[model samples]
Target: MTEQGDTHVKRKMPKGVRKGGTRFPRQTLGDSLAWAKKLVAKTHLGPQPEGVVLSGVVGNSNSVGRVRLSTLKQFGLMEGDSKGYIASDLAKRIEAAPTEERSALYRAAVLAPPVFKALFDTFHGDEVTHAKLKQRAAELKVHPEETGKCADVYVTSMVTAGLATLDGDKIAHLSAIDMGTPPPSPLITEQGDTDEPKVADDDGEGPEDETQPEAPNPKRAIFNVNVTLDSSLDTEKLERQLRLLKKFGAI
Candidate 1:
């Protein structure tokens, strides 16, 4: 199934409690945990652009730019050049389980980790700084308070269960993977080899093709275009050409 399909399936809660009731603590926790497990199962970790994951979760480049630097430090998911926090190992385990067992597995995983709450708190606080969250809450057709609460609980559950990590505020770390640097280009070696091609001299005794090309001229190029029009040209066409010339500063 698709990742979104898995998320939808995982988000489904048993029909025992009201839509937003704190009274059904067991059910809420169970549902959150179950959802977390499914998310973990579906996610993969690798070197993704900061923009990709952040775009998936957060809207607005301004919000993302504000949070990424601080969040990465707080989560310890990435260090220096190597970007970390793809997915947690727990997510993989839960995803491997049977469909029927996933809910319970998620529940257990979330409850097992203490850092989940901390991660949730960090992001929840960060999200409020952006106006887009409020806008998104309205668009989703839910009260902002309810949406915020759901986000908090859901993120916390995912983190606790090892399905997600706050690698950065804008992007969740899933799949417990690390990204490596790209390999060097093979074209570099080929170009180096071509640099020293031997050329036969007129005497057939010495190399003549080893020299490199001369440096390019640093002076800028100058060019002009001239258009000749008859004095009796159509007024409308002349006006349009004049306007174009004015726009290009060639009038």
Candidate 2:
């Protein structure tokens, strides 16, 4: 009778919403961001009471709502605490940025948490696993029992934030950002001059907003790419081309 009752209770709550979990956000960075935006809109980008923020952000000022609010704070999307809460500047920018620009903004938000940032810095562009997260958590000094929940949050958050791509049941690639990548670093020449080039990402889309290639594989397959530079050393774009190749680690 207790087992049947427990099953019925589980059906009453939202998916992924529970009474207990890790110290970090139970919601993915992406979901938290989306909800944060809504809260900002509801509150007119100003501070509001905990209940007000929670009601705006999560639909009800319940325990789950409190967790959602905490998730926003953890992702650096929302500010203040249970007493009062407000959206962060980053959240505002994300609110205003267009679709393409939001991609980079999302990445920035995902790396806001110290643990999440550390995880990305240490393990990005490599295969990520729950065991790896738990191991790293030990290194980070997180509670042993919290390791499993931590891993679950990180994996789901990265995928939702587009920082990691998946292949079937496994994540294939964890996107690489500079120590603090995004917003495109200043493209400085060897000399004391600067030239900003249209940088292409893994998808080969640049600032010009080029049409995406049909079915470009997201898998980081080991394949060789050819680059043919002109013999003339005076080509203005040569520096840009070389710099771009270097960014892709092709040099």
Candidate 1 lDDT over 137-180, as tens digits, reads: 43444444455544554555555544555444443534222212
Tens-digit lDDT track for model 2 on 78-140? 888777787788888989889878877887888787877777767776776667778886677
Worst 10 residues of 2 by lDDT: 177-186
* Candidate closest to the true structure, highest TM-score: 2
- Local distance difference test, each candidate: 0.42, 0.72
Quick one: RMSD of model 1?
A: 24.7
Give stretches of model 1 more than 4 Å off.
1-45, 57-82, 112-251
- Single out the weakest 10-residue window by summed lDDT for candidate 1: 176-185
In model 2, the runs with Cα more than 4 Å from the true position are 1-23, 175-251
- The alpha-carbon deviation from the true structure for residue 44 of candidate 1, after best TM-score superposition, in angstroms, is 4.0
